[model samples]
Target: MARCFSKLTQTSVRIEVGGGRSFDCPMLPVSAIDEFDGIREMLGSVDKPETLREVFRRLREMAARVLPEEYAPGLARFTLDKLIELVAYLIYGDDDDQPAGGQAPADAEDDLYEAKKK
Candidate 1:
């Protein structure tokens, strides 16, 4: 998807995604740093936006193929917001309050035993 924005007083903006997997956008001018910062600050407080949902969906699908079935089910239930938090923490070493997706490693074993009993 690609979107362009131009306002009366601001510079033109262009955002583009190719192959639904990558971004190809023009770099903002150095003078736009404050404007960019303001935009980021405003966006940071918003709930996980729909624009991110598709990316998270693709990531989850990839993880499913590599993860064990027991873990896949739990991971499939994660919201885009949770995925974002997890990735951010992994990449930036930031502490996110949410738990990582996938089955609890130990609990999966317990579940198998409980299922056999039933």
Candidate 2:
């Protein structure tokens, strides 16, 4: 089936966040590419955004609490791009966030959305 093939094609990417740290992120499901793009665009608009140090710290802490310790380090080292994708997964990957038709929230706009709507 197409679904099975899609899953098989997906890969986990390792992001190097410098200082020899890295994180492994499961690639976005093919069906969710648009959502992933939206999240990426949204993340690009912040001014003087938080340092990678802070983001990595939080991500590591979150991973440690939610995932096994071995997986935490990888999640923490995610590059900015990978971090965005991972964040999208965290926010919209679950059943609670999924609607009857698997639609994500429409309000999930990127930075461009905010600028245009304003």
* lDDT values, one for every candidate: 0.41, 0.46
State TM-scores per candidate.
Answer: 0.27, 0.33
Task: Tell me model 2's lDDT, rounded to 2 decimals.
Answer: 0.46
Q: lDDT, candidate 2, residue 111?
A: 39
lDDT of 1 at 83: 49
Could you give candidate 2's per-residue lDDT for residues 1-118 as a string of tens digits?
A: 1121222322434434478665544534454556545544554664545644554454444334434456666764677666655555543453223233333333332333568778
* Alpha-carbon RMSD, each predicted model: 21.0, 15.8
Give the per-residue lDDT digits (tens) of candidate 1, residues 1-118. 3222222112212221245332212223444345434443544565667635545555455444434455556766777666444333222231211113333323544576579889
Worst 10 residues of 2 by lDDT: 1-10
Q: What C-alpha lDDT, on a 0 to 100 scale, does residue 61 get in candidate 2?
A: 45
